[model samples]
Target: MKTQLEELQTQLTKAKQYGTDQETLNKNLLRILKERANAERGIIPKKQHHGYIILCSQQLIKKDNIKYSEAVTAWKTQIQTPYPLNLKSSEIKDQIFKDFVEKNIFIEMEICTDSLDIKTECEVNLQQYLFRANTRTGYWEIELYTTGEITIPLNMQQPKKNATGSCSTFQKDSIKSNVR
Candidate 1:
């Protein structure tokens, strides 16, 4: 199991470096490895799991008449992962705020509560597009002019109007990207 984990780690590194779609498969393999580790440590033993790579490779080699070497080298390349985000939390907030101001994204938030009724409306800037506050669904949404929209749910079915709302915190190491 340790050797398998090492091999999967190597594959994951290669996939990331080569910008291959195999990264997802490598990640899944890593997750399976973690589960196996947990089971070995006397955690709940999950049902046996197997990846379909072996069957797919076999089919490609036999049915498609492809060489084993060809099947092994079939790593579909994709866009490389973006550079890591290393900005501080304050820096991230500043950058996001700058983007909002630059994009001219209008933000409006309201909160009202009574003995029996609680209602909130919130709009945050996302992707320099049209923003909407869905008070009924308790989600702040940003609809792109193109096709889809990005919806961020409010915590506990309520939107908090503050410097930082109910969204996840932007830690220095964990933040992946800025507004872009």
Candidate 2:
């Protein structure tokens, strides 16, 4: 609860800088005050597990026909994609909140396979939730329980520097779930 209060205060400060509308700012200020009061009274927000699907890139190349002798280096360098799942989508929020449960929030993500454009769906039970409100948009940004670095294997044929894919950005009731 204290963490949440602090986040709210931070949002409020950012909201002022971002020129958020007065009406929305007022509402958020009221909400923050109420939450602060609750925190002082030892009241905590109920934990929730909102459901959403994270679209991950599986593979870009399909065929591997290069000979071993033609390879410049046999050793592979690991490329870590920072927060590949740090997605913000309003569509996802709508889908998740449509079936939102009050007491528990579990995020479901799919793992990618070796094949290009293929995904293997897996159910990961997230036991924790970190949520915040977007000060400018009044949207909910739910941080993922995992905030670790993701290692992405690079394609030897196409070794571009800092190659990352674009993710969907959703505002107005959004979730900023990242696996960075």
Candidate 3:
């Protein structure tokens, strides 16, 4: 896994150095996108064109050859960004890719919810294992937070009335229930 990831990182670096040119950049982006999508969704390339590529998983292609052009278009667009690919920005991009890669890694990992506690004031303590992947390294974070009460503006949900009696009984009931 490490070797494969390293090779991908090197390829990504080379692709960035190749600049915003159409052919070289798009091809490199397609390669990286294919690998990442395959890792995430078990997809494989079926055909390639000058500006587009078709991808489908082996099973799906064998069954019906359903291609996802939206995925290809998104990948192509991301790689051809005009911005300089610095380490910080590259790291951010890699983080997004890593998220795609590590999604399934947590499927079998048991969530440790034994430490969670709920308070009477509508406050709840939550802990969750977040898995993230990128060009550089995979990431795992145990996020802990307390969810406090949420308040929505009443005017956004209902029209304001100059007179209190302008609101019907049903409207009063809806406001009591905090429902629009």
Candidate 4:
């Protein structure tokens, strides 16, 4: 039984690599089982067979989640295109929230600073919840499971505007020109 289980595990791994879809994998597994023993009489023990399937399913789920998270992170990092600050900000925020949802990390609270600097603190019930950011300098703080806290500082230079381009000055100038 142990040898059979090991052989089945090897076959399942190969089947996963070769099969393009779940139906194909299932058909291949069924064919292997039928070849091993006559299905008319009976096959492997139900409990043992189910245990193998369950273990394989768990492994596949973990692999898929990791791949998905990596893809999302990559996509999130490329949001700064097309020369518009407001649009980029919205896109970045949306991507962050989406990734958080996909990884099942609940956001307890979020705070955005007025000066384009964001400071956020979050708590996750599970220890596996890891928060990451592409911009190393983005202002953020994370506290995980009562262990410790992480602070990320952002590099934000103050906006530079010509003194003559001030809104108040523009309005005064417009009024003065109208009076003249």
Candidate 5:
């Protein structure tokens, strides 16, 4: 009777605290299970981040002959696009929250201070139940469990060097922007 009562209490507790979309809940549950397995194996799990973006080359070249490296050869005319440290979009936040709940899908991301460092390999996991979005200020705060950053050699030179911390400036560069 005590075990049955305890089980019922656990279910009730879960019901009361769950506020995320149903899909994300499923993902969290799965994550918990996996974490438990890792704990048993004595392998400390590393963290992934809440968000990250990828910039691919824009120019595409057609290939006359197919080869093993043909796919990459197509994008010869391309600039190295840097990743956005933190994206502030309602659409992205919504998508991430939903994806996390349903699939526990965590996108790769780097922290703001270490964007230029090539050695910084960042992975992201949305910290459960800490997502927040403020539209007025364009601030989207989401707690992410992450593997801490490390100093790495700067390989890819960034065209746009943002201020060290999150800045509120929109200073134009000497070169005119292509934006309309």
Candidate 6:
């Protein structure tokens, strides 16, 4: 989850840097990610995910698959005997990922960036685990990892309106662009 958000943000950054339209792409992707995370936490109804990457937005965040290969390789180097973790698409709502949090052993951390100017950072917590190496060997290995949704500090949800019921955050021109 953390990795996905990072990739999204990195794509957003590159799009903006190259004078592409980041407005449309960013919000849609954020909302999609937000909803998926909410469903996983049981805050929203879970739907059958068809393994299909959300279509249409592909051109918006198109990335060179090899661009981050080096970083990912470096990250995986620290792991040994990489067996499949107990994670599965069907288990999104399971609290297996929250064990450390519920036990208060792992501290939750948040790194937020202001979205007003299209700058954003996300929550990340690196955890270290001691796993038994190769069920046959009486040895252990250490693995560092993080899982769960990336926290967006700036609320993309509509802001609370005053008694008069008028929104102040978005302007007509801004709304027009997003309509596209």
Top candidate by lDDT: 5
lDDT of 5 at 60: 27
What are the RMSDs of all candidates, in order? Answer: 26.0, 19.3, 23.0, 25.7, 18.7, 25.3
My TM-score estimates for the predictions, one after another, are 0.16, 0.20, 0.16, 0.16, 0.20, 0.18
Model 6 weakest lDDT span, ten residues long: 51-60
CA lDDT, candidate 2, residue 41 = 26
Q: Residue 53 in model 5: shift from native, Å?
A: 6.8
- Candidate 5 residue-wise lDDT, 12-123, digit = tens: 8888667456768866754554354333323333122222111111222234333445532211111111112244444445554454344323222233222133354444
* Per-model tally of clashing residue pairs: 0, 12, 4, 1, 10, 0
> Tens-digit lDDT track for model 6 on 1-180?
999999999999997876656656754553565455434333323232211111011001113333564322111001211122333323332232332244222232231222122244434434333232323321122233333222222221112331111122112221121113
lDDT of 2 by residue, 1-180 (tens): 999999999999988877767757865653554354333322334111111212122211112323343422111112111111233454334433333332122222221222223354533222233444434323334533322222322221112332222223322222222213
The reply for model 3, stretches above 4 Å from the true place, is 1-86, 93-103, 111-180
User: lDDT per prediction?
Assistant: 0.28, 0.32, 0.27, 0.27, 0.33, 0.29
Q: Which ranges in model 6 have alpha carbons more than 4 Å from their true place?
A: 1-95, 108-133, 137-180
lDDT of 1 by residue, 1-180 (tens): 999999999999987877766666755654565355333322333323211000000000122323344431111101100011232334334433343344322121121112212244423212222223333322233322211122312211221221212223212221122222
Candidate 4 local lDDT, 53-128, one digit each (tens):
0000000012233536442111000111111222244433544444335422232212122222235543312232
Q: Scored by Cα lDDT, where does model 1 land?
A: 0.28
Residue 4 error for model 5, in Å?
51
- Evaluated against the true structure, the overall lDDT of model 3 is 0.27
Worst 10 residues of 1 by lDDT: 51-60
